[model samples]
Target: MKVLIITYYWPPSGGSGVQRWLKFVKYLQDFGVEPVVYTVENPKYPILDASLEKEIPKNITILKEPIWEPNNILSFFKKENTQQSAGFLNPNPTFFGKILQYIRANYFIPDARKFWIQPSVKYLKKYLSEHKIDAVITSGPPHSLHLIGLELKKALNIKWISDFRDPWTEIDYFEQLPLTKKSIRLHQQLEQEVVEKSDAVLVVGQTMKENFSKFSKNIHVITNGFDNDIDSTSITLDKKFTITHVGLMNADRNPISLWKAISDICNENADFTADYEIQFVGKIASEVRHSLEEYQIKKVLDVGYVSHQEVTKYQQKAQVLLLAVNNVKSAKGVITGKIFEYLQAKRPILAIGPTNGDLAEILKETNAGTIVNFNDVENLKKEILQLYSSFKNGNLESKSNNIEHYHRRNLTEKLAHIIKETVS
Candidate 1:
């Protein structure tokens, strides 16, 4: 089967989002499928982790089109280099940037990718005329990818699959988007259309599937998993009570209360003061920093974002992995993309966020981590001290059974199955 994937995030970019589709494409051929990817040429927001680009399968067809992000144009006038591995325009927009956002919010039919729609629709239509494809799958957060799939399905009669890496309206962080009434309404209408028209819809978790099932009957849950290729050898340490958290750190997911407990414990206990490292890898939110300060935990270390290849090094170094969920009811359904990688690292994880979420369930099932609630600062502090003591006393270890279900190959095979059913 020949499958065309319309996704905004892809390799040369490395973060949790890109890994899903990138790894899916990697294993599609083994399941008797050929994948032709249509992705943005220069994505507006990108964290360039080139280590992941090496995973893109060879001999696969890649269709690239220039995405007209207005923010990029203003950056050009400002003498900014938009092509850096860290993709996209900076968040602190210039005067032109605000105007561009306004136009995108109001003038664009549904999404910011409205500009790319005309070019994508035109280019893809011509390409489809000459080539044969069994299916069309669009994965999105930009959701513009779904628009591309929707158009192609209408014009070419190709079976379409709309994959949501995150929920649309029900997304936990949707409230953070400062969208106008018109933009919100437009977004809802487009979302409804995608849910109704697609032959199949794919989501990351059971909770997301349930949330989406209210909109459409054709929904499936295919959770994210870790890439087996990440080498877990670089930071193999013998004695260090290191706790590590990777990926984006938004204000919501920052466990401020837990930090307070940690700081208090560190201040009171001479043992914790003598041997403990709170190593935060990747981006850190101001809220987390403030909490760390409030707790007087002066030992906070920010090892700025590193390449994907280097992530395993840090993971291997960690005695306990940290998984955080924002303090939201919607977060219960969110099974972060980082958890799988943490699993592959084969370290004892410490989940400190939501108590009832999918992350907790996974940890309980795998016995991979010690789970703690967001508000339970006392218990969180106890767990921290226990883990620290275990590391200090050489007693910390992973007791979880193997979780074969989360292997990337299995997840990709499931993706292939969805494509087969959609095309059939």
Candidate 2:
């Protein structure tokens, strides 16, 4: 069997967006599926890691076409105001920035990547005619990629699967978009169309699957996972009681309660103050920085944008791994990809968000970590103290169980089964 994957993020372009499909492609051949990747030739990627190129399987076909994104033109007007990546919602906007946000929310329709839909559909229509692809899959954030698959399904009548790495209309930042009522309805309409028309809809978490179940019966929950190949044994643990978060810490993801709790703990406990160090390992929003400063937390190490290989090392070294879900209306559904990687690191995890949410469920099931509510400063402080006490006693470790199910290769096997069923 052969599958054609339509994705915006690919190797040489790094971060959580690229990892899911990249790992799927890496392991699919073992399950008797030949993967053909279709991606942008030149993308305005917010983060880049040439190291990820090493993960691409040898002798696989990678198709690329040039994408004309409006962000390229709009970015020139407000270079300082423009976000380096998508999904980082600015809680406060300048007057000019608000104008750009208004245009992006209302005029851009689905996204700035909407411009690539027509051109991609036109290019792929001819290519599909000659190709022996048995099934089509489109992954999105730039949900515009799904429009291409939707069009191809109509034109070529191929078996198409629409994969939601993140929710579209229900995304955390949707409310912050400055969207008009009509624009909001349009987004919902497009989201419904993509879900209902596709042969299958794959989502990263159970909450997403439940949310989209009204639109499509063929929804599947395929969570992002960790590669088993990474060598975790060689990494040396940090001497300090390092609490590290390893991905983009946007304004929404900034755990204010946790910071406040830690600040209070540092002031009250002399031993913790002497040993504890907070480390942020990727692109941090300005708001996150301001919050840290407000707490008067001094021992901060901002090691921005390390390669995937380096990230694994950081994860292994940390005394406690931190996972912060976006404190938004959609917080219950927001399961960031780093959670599984944290599980694989075998370090105790300290997470802050909806305590009754999907992430908390996983942490509870695996016995990998402790979770506190977004505003639960008392419990947050208690959890931190407990982890710190365990660190002092040399008992700081994650007892993650039944975690083989979350290995990258195992997850790919499950994905291949879906592709086979869809094609058949």
Candidate 3:
């Protein structure tokens, strides 16, 4: 099977978005599928990790085109970088930035990357005509990439799969955008069209599958998995009781209650404070910083924007991994890719979100750790104290089971099966 993957995030585009298909592509050939990647030549990615380039399959066909983005121009007016990893929205935008956001939300429709869709479709339409492709997979958001797949399916009647790393209308920040009713309707209509028309719709979680099933019967839940190149046996745990979060902790993911719990514990127990450390490995919203300050918690470490290679080191060494799901209506389906790596790190996980949500289910299945609801500060404190006790006893390790199914190679084999079925 020759599958052409059309994506906005690719090699050197360091972040969660790129890791999913990158790992799938890395091991696709072992399952008898040829992976051809289509991505931008000059992408305005928020983060860069040239180290990821080494993961690309040798001799794989990679198609590239230059993309023109408005982020650089908009950044000057916004007074900050517009292309933040994991859709890091500025909570307090300047007056001029609000105007830009309005234009982006209402005018751009899906995203500013709308410009790339037509050009990509035009190029791929020609490329598909000349190649022997079994199927085409388009990943999003920038959900605009699905528009390209939609157009190609219309033009060439190609077997297309639309992969949603996150939901469309149900995304956590969908309401955050200053969108008018017409714009909202347009987004919904486009999303429906893509879901209904694609041969398959791949989502990262079951809630998304259930939600999108209203539009299509071909929805598949293919959760993200961990794929670290480093040997895990060589890495050692941190000497301090480190509770680490390895990805974007935007305003939505801020666990103010958990911070308060930790703060209270710090004041109560001097020894606990002495041995405790909190670490954030990527971009965090200012709101989170304010929460930490409001709780008067110290010993916070900001290892700003390290490469994936470095991210795993932080994960494996941590005494506890912190998984914060967005405390929003759509958060039930919002499973961040970082959680898989945290699971693979085999450290006890401490989560804050909906207890009955998808993430909680995974944690329960693996017997990895405990999850406290967003408002449960008391439980957060109890969980923390228990973890601290375990650390002191030298028995703080994750007893995860059935996690091998989430390895990159196994996931790719499933994807390969889907491609074969689609082609047949």
| Best-fitting candidate, scored by TM-score | 2
lDDT of each candidate versus the true structure:
0.78, 0.91, 0.89
Residue 336 of model 2 has an lDDT of 94
Candidate 3 lDDT, tens digit per residue, 1-424? 7999999899788988899999999999999999999999898877889999999989899999988877667766643545453367677877876787788888886998888988898899889989999889999988999999999999989899999999999999998889999999999999999999999989999999999999999888889998754577898899999999988889999998899899899989999999999999998888999998898878999998898888888999999999999988988777889888888888999999999999989888888888899999999999999999999999988888888888888888888888888888
- Candidate 3, position 148, lDDT: 92
In order of appearance, the predictions have TM-scores of: 0.90, 0.98, 0.97
Model 3 gets an lDDT of 0.89
Give the per-residue lDDT of model 2 (tens digit) for 134-179. 9899999889999999999999999999999999999988888899
RMSD of each: 3.3, 1.2, 1.4
* lDDT for model 2: 0.91
**What pairs collide in candidate 3?**
none
Q: Return the lDDT, model 2, position 93.
A: 74
User: What clash pairs does model 1 have?
Assistant: 44-88, 46-87
lDDT of residue 386 for candidate 3: 96
Question: Distance (Å) between predicted and true CA of 79, model 2?
Answer: 3.3
